[model samples]
Every structure is written in C-alpha cells, then in structure tokens.
Target chain A: EAGVAQSPRYKIIEKRQSVAFWCNPISGHATLYWYQQILGQGPKLLIQFQNNGVVDDSQLPKDRFSAERLKGVDSTLKIQPAKLEDSAVYLCASSYGPDRGTDTQYFGPGTRLTVL
Target chain B: AQRVTQPEKLLSVFKGAPVELKCNYSYSGSPELFWYVQYSRQRLQLLLRHISRESIKGFTADLNKGETSFHLKKPFAQEEDSAMYYCALSRSNYQLIWGAGTKLIIKP
Candidate 1:
C-alpha cells in the first residue's frame, strides 16, 4: 500500500498570510491526523478526523487554524494569519482505525511551512 | 494529564557499540508505548510498540510499568541507526502524548 501523500513540500509566507496544505491518506484508512512539529520538538496533534467527521481538535487554535476531511479520503489544513510561531513542519498521518490512537500510523513527507 | 519525556536531547555513540535511548512517561492507567524514528529526509516510521513485545531493526524496548519507562536499546549500533527517535504514550482517551525526541548519532 502507498504511504500517505502530502503536497507543497515546502512553503514560505509572510506573517498574517494564509496557507493551506493537502493530504491523501493511505487506501482504506479511516483515521487521518494533522500535526505540527516545531524545530527541536515532537509533533503535536492539530486535528484528527474519522471518516469525514472530526474526532479531536482540542489543541487546535480555532481562531486561525481549521481543517477538513471531506469524504474521508482527503484532508486539508489551513492556517490563516500565520504567525512566526506557526513556522513548523505540518505532518499528515493515517491508520486503519476508527479513532484508535494505538493503531500504527503511516506518515507522509511533511510540508515545511516557513512564516516570515 | 499524560505526558512523555525523553531526557536526552542528543546522544552519540561509536559504531558497533551498544545504544540506549531513555524514555519516561506519566499516565494514570496501563500505557501503550511506541517508538518512532525519522531518518534524514524520510517520513517518520514506527519502530516498535510495547503491546506486541517485539523488536524491530535490532531495537527492543521493555515497558517497565513499575519504573514508568520504556527505554529503547540495541546491542550493536550501526551508522544507519542514526536518526531522530520519539517516544509516545497512548492516553486512555486514545490520544497520544509525545516526547520532544532524541537525536542519535552513530559515529563510524
């Protein structure tokens, strides 16, 4: 099976600008996740989706960040008014799961966002 | 609140030597631990999980519930083993708490 795929391997935008990233999860994966990994740190969960419905987004900054997994096959994460602190690698992962975090997750080459 | 901690930010060892990466977690219930690795320019991949009691790529981690640790170890380190390793704990709610990660350098 192919791994998760992500678009825009690298992006640079000025502060307050908006940026979007796309992800295609592995075939038949019911759970999709978006994470933000800062330099020198581990990835933090931004949002989680289970078959087109959100399962978790408590850590997401609702004011400027949003994500959607329409149709449960593809997902898009958007960051509006990107701040310098938002400069990080945006990672996408998926698993054969129904909101099971213990499932082995297949990852994609993350999109590195640079907010200047 | 559940949390994962990797005390060493970086560790360097010579090739063919033993390697150990420390990990400690805090959770109320029985924890599901995992070790993930990322090589240069590669996507992060799961190396092993505590539930299976299996070793991958010559690496093994014992989940010591009494000590609250799951330390990854390999008998003989290879240059190819150099990468960033992350320890994660699965919470009761099925969410994950991740550690900052440790960068392992295998010197040839």
Candidate 2:
C-alpha cells in the first residue's frame, strides 16, 4: 500500500519569510498529524486532525504556525515570519483511525526546512 | 510532566553481537510504549509495541513498569540493523511523548 506523501522534500527560506509544507495521508486513513523534528531530537507534534476536524494543536505556535486538513485527505502546515530555530524536519503521519495510540502511524519522508 | 528518555545518543555493536537500546519514560497512568525505527532514506516505522508483545526482526522490548523502562534488545545484530530508534510513551492515551532517539550502528 502507498504510504503518506509529502511535497518538496527539502526547503530553504530566509528569516521573517513564509514557508509552507504539504502532506497527503494514506488512503482511507482517518487521523492525520504534523510533527516538527529538530536535529538530534525526536518529533514534536504541531497539530492533529481527525477527518477535517482538529483534534489537538496545543503545541502549535499560534502566533506564526498554522495547519489545515481540508477535505479530510490532505494537509498543509505553514510558518510565517520564520525564525532560525524553525529549521527542522517536518513530518506528516496518518493512522487508520483515532485509536488513542493503539493504531500504527505511517509517516512520510518529511520535508527538511532551513531558515537562514 | 510526561517525558521519554534515551540515555544513549549512539550505540555501536558488531555483527552477531548482542544489542540493547535503553528507553525510560515518566507518566502517571498506564502508559503504552512503542519503538519506532528510521533507516537511512526511509520513513519512520513502528518496530514494535508493548501491547503487541511480538518481536519484529529478531528484536524484542519488554516494558518494566517498576523500572519505567522499555529497552529494545536483540541477541544477534545484523548490518541492516543500523538505524535510529525512538522510544515513545502514550500520554493520556492520545498524545505521544518521544525520546531523543538512539543511533544504532552495527559494524560488519
């Protein structure tokens, strides 16, 4: 089966600029998530969506980061006025359902973003 | 707060040697543990989970609540075993708290 797909596997932008990453979850998957993984660190969730409705986004920086899962199949995460510290790999994952952690999460290749 | 710790940043083992990747977590309720592996040029994938109690690729991890650890172990390592392994704990059965990750290198 096809796994989660992401676009522009790598990106580079200047500070205070805007950058956006796109993600398309696995077919028939119902839960989607976006995570930021800094170098030498594990992934930190930025947002989660269940069938086009937001499930959680507490870790998201509302001032500059935003994400949307329109039509419940695709998602986009955007960061405006980016900062140097925002340079990290952005991963997208999806699960068959919101099984509260039991379901296996399939991840994408991730987009490596560098802010100068 | 909930957190996961991988004491070792990097672990090197010879082929056919034993391998162990330590993982510890802090949580209040009954936590679900998972080990995820990311090979070079590959996406992150589930290696195993505590609930499943099944070994994958000859690797097994046993969750010890008293010790608050779920260490991944394999009696015999292979060259293809080289990868980044992450330990994660389910928080409130909804979110996951992940460890920094351990880079495993199996020398031929």
Candidate 3:
C-alpha cells in the first residue's frame, strides 16, 4: 500500500520570504497532520485535520502559518514571512479514523526548509 | 501541560545485547503512550503503543503509571536496530506531545 506522500523534499528561502509544503495522505485515511521538527528534536504537532475540517491547530502560529485540507485528502501548509527560526523539517502524517482500534499514524518523507 | 521526556540523547550497545530506551511523561488523566522509530533516511513510523500490549520487531514497552514511565526494550539488539526513537503522549485524538528523541546505535 502507498504511504503518505509529500512534495519538495527540500526547500530554501530567505527570511521574510514565503514557503509552502504539500502532503498527500494514504488512501482512506481520515486524519491528516502537519508537524515541525527542528534539528536534534522530535517532530512537533503544528496542525491536524479530520476530513475537510480542522481538528486541532492550537500550536500553529496564526500570525505566520496557515494550512488547509480542502478536499479532505490532500493538504498544504504555508508559512509567510519566514524567519530564521522557522528553518526546520516539515513533516506530514496520516492515520485511519478513530473507528480503527489502533490509529497508528504513517508519516511522509518530510520537507526540509532552510530559511537564511 | 503534557510532556514527554527521553533522558538519553544517545545510546550504544553491542549486537546481541539487550537494549532499553527510557521515556517519562507528565499527564493528569489517563495517558496513551507510543514509541516511534526512524531509520536512516526513513520517515518516522510507529514502533509500538502502550495499549496494544504487543511487541514489534522484538521491541516492547510497558507503561508504568506509578513512575510515569514508558521505556522501550528489545532483546538481542541488531545493527538494523540502529535508529532514532521517540516517545509520545496523546493529548487528544489529534494532538500528541513528543520527546526530544534517542538515537540508538548498535555495534557489530
């Protein structure tokens, strides 16, 4: 079976520039998530979506970050006016809905964003 | 506030030796814990969950509520076992708190 997929495995941008990352989850999975992993750290949850609606985004930087799962299958996370501190790997993950006894999340090959 | 702690940033063991990666967490209510692994150049994937009570790739973890710890263990470590491991706690269905992660290195 195909796993979660992401685009632009690597990206570089200058501070104050904008960047976007895309994700395509596994088929039939109902939950999608975006995470940020700074070097030497584990991935931090940035946002989550169930179907076409957001389930949680409390950690998202509302002033600079935005994400959308319009059709409920694919998602895009964007950061505007990127800062040097924003340089990190952007990871995408997905899971089968809660109905499944074990909601194991599968992750994609993250996009490494380097803001100079 | 929920938190996951991995005390060790790096651990090394010889092949055929036992391996343990320590994890501790802080949560008030019922806690759900998970272990995720990422091999070199691979995406992070679930290794095990406390609720399952099942072992994967000879690795297992038991949640100790009394001490607030969930440590991953494996017997007879192999070179293939070298990877980064992360312990996480679920705050909600869609939210998870993760530790800094531990890098396990197995010597031949």
Candidate 4:
C-alpha cells in the first residue's frame, strides 16, 4: 500500500561534511535494503537488514558509511566526511520476507544527495 | 558473482511498433531474473519477474536458460511505454545485481 517512505527528498552537503538519510519500510515488511544509484547507473546495494539484524553489508564503506535498522522497521544511513563521489540518489526498498526473493520490492522516491 | 547486462543504453520506436528490450545475465546457479521500470518523476517499480512467467503492461519476457537471456518484448509499443528499464539477477543468498539500464522512448 503506502510503499516505502524516505525523508528529505533532497540533501546537499560539502565535502568532508556529514549527512544522514531516513527511511521507513512498508508495514509488515521484514526485509529492508539500501541502495545507491548514481546518475546514468543502476542501483547498487549498500546494505540489507532482516528485522534489525544485518543480513549483508559487504558493499558498505565501513570507513565512512554506516547504516542501521533499529527496531526492524525504520532505517538510517549515515555518511561521515562525505566525498564528492558520494553524490547520488539513495534508495530504500522493502519486501515481505526473504522467501519471496522474487517478490516485488516496494521503493521510496529516494533521497537525492549532492556533495559539493 | 552474478551480473546483468542491458546492451542498449537507449531504444527508440514509433507508436504501434513492436518493441524489444534485451537483457542478458550471467550466474553460476539457477538464477532469478526481474525487470524494473522507472517513469519520469516516479519511483522505480517492478515490471515483471521471470519466475512468474507473466506479462504486465503488454510487456512479456521469456527466460532462455540456454541463451542466458531474458528479453522483454511487446507486440505493439505505446507512447506511455517510455521509461527507464533495468534488468536484475539474484542468486541464492545475495542481493539482486542490476544492469546499467535502458531508456526506452516511444515516439508519438
């Protein structure tokens, strides 16, 4: 129904600054994902959470990027000391369960971050 | 590692013409494939998945395991079909791998 929800549809920060994004998954969704989509490129998975426990974070930049899905419903992605290269659209998606891997992933409008 | 590829960056066709959006994937295991679409100013949404063997919005894709391809096609294209399409592949435990995506423009 309501689909995933994201806050601050757009954000701008200077290089070396910090930024954070918020996302709320659909009700009853047990799996949530964060992805980065640069212009002209496909969305790349950053992290995945299965009810507050991380299922995957292989691509996340531990040095400066981190994400947490506390309480298993809402998630927040933070980037400390943002780099110009970090400028991209941050997308959040959620699914009912892991068993439904082929099921549709409801996506939010995404947070467009611009690092100057 | 699994990979998805959308060879064409852009495809243009006139209204009422046949349309095809090619998608090729490489994976070690029996892969699951999906097609996602994003219209202007809209969030990306799933178009269809190969496992279901179904069609949506007049678009259908047939999985060819031998060819390692899952090309989306429609008998006739409409102007409203214009959008960005991405092909994705998922393995056993990993997340979906996506292609660069193709922008389909249906000319009026």
Q: What share of the true interface contacts does each candidate keep?
A: 0.73, 0.79, 0.85, 0.76
Clashing pairs in model 3, backbone N/Cα/C closer than 3 A: none
Candidate 3: residue B99 Cα off by (Å): 0.8
List the pairs of residues colliding in candidate 4: none
What candidate 2 gets wrong by more than 4 Å, as runs, is A99-101
- For lDDT, candidate 3 versus 4, the one ahead is 3
Give each prediction's root-mean-square deviation over alpha carbons.
1.3, 1.3, 1.1, 1.1
Cα displacement (angstroms), candidate 3, residue B26, comes to: 0.7
Report the lDDT tens digits of candidate 1 across residue range A1-116. 78999999999999999999999999999989899999999999999898898989999999999999998899999999899999999999998874444478889999999999
Poorest lDDT segment (10 consecutive residues) of candidate 4 chain A: A96-105
Question: What CAPRI grade goes to candidate 1?
Answer: medium
Per-residue lDDT for B4-107 in model 4, tens only?
99999999999999999999999988988999999999999999998889989999999999999999999999999999999999766647899999999999
Q: How accurate is candidate 2 locally (lDDT)?
A: 0.93
- Candidate 3, residue B84: Cα displacement in angstroms equals 0.1
Model 4 per-residue lDDT at B94: 47
Native-referenced DockQ of model 1? 0.79
Residue A91's lDDT in candidate 4: 99
Evaluated on chain B only, what are the TM-scores of all the candidate structures, in order? 0.97, 0.98, 0.97, 0.97
lDDT of 3 by residue, A14-101 (tens): 9999999999999999999999999999898899899999988989998999999998999999999899999999999998867674
In candidate 2, position B14 carries an lDDT of 99
Model 4 per-residue lDDT tens digits across residues A1-116: 68899998999889999999999999999889999999999999999898999999999999999999899999999999899999999999998766655346889999999999
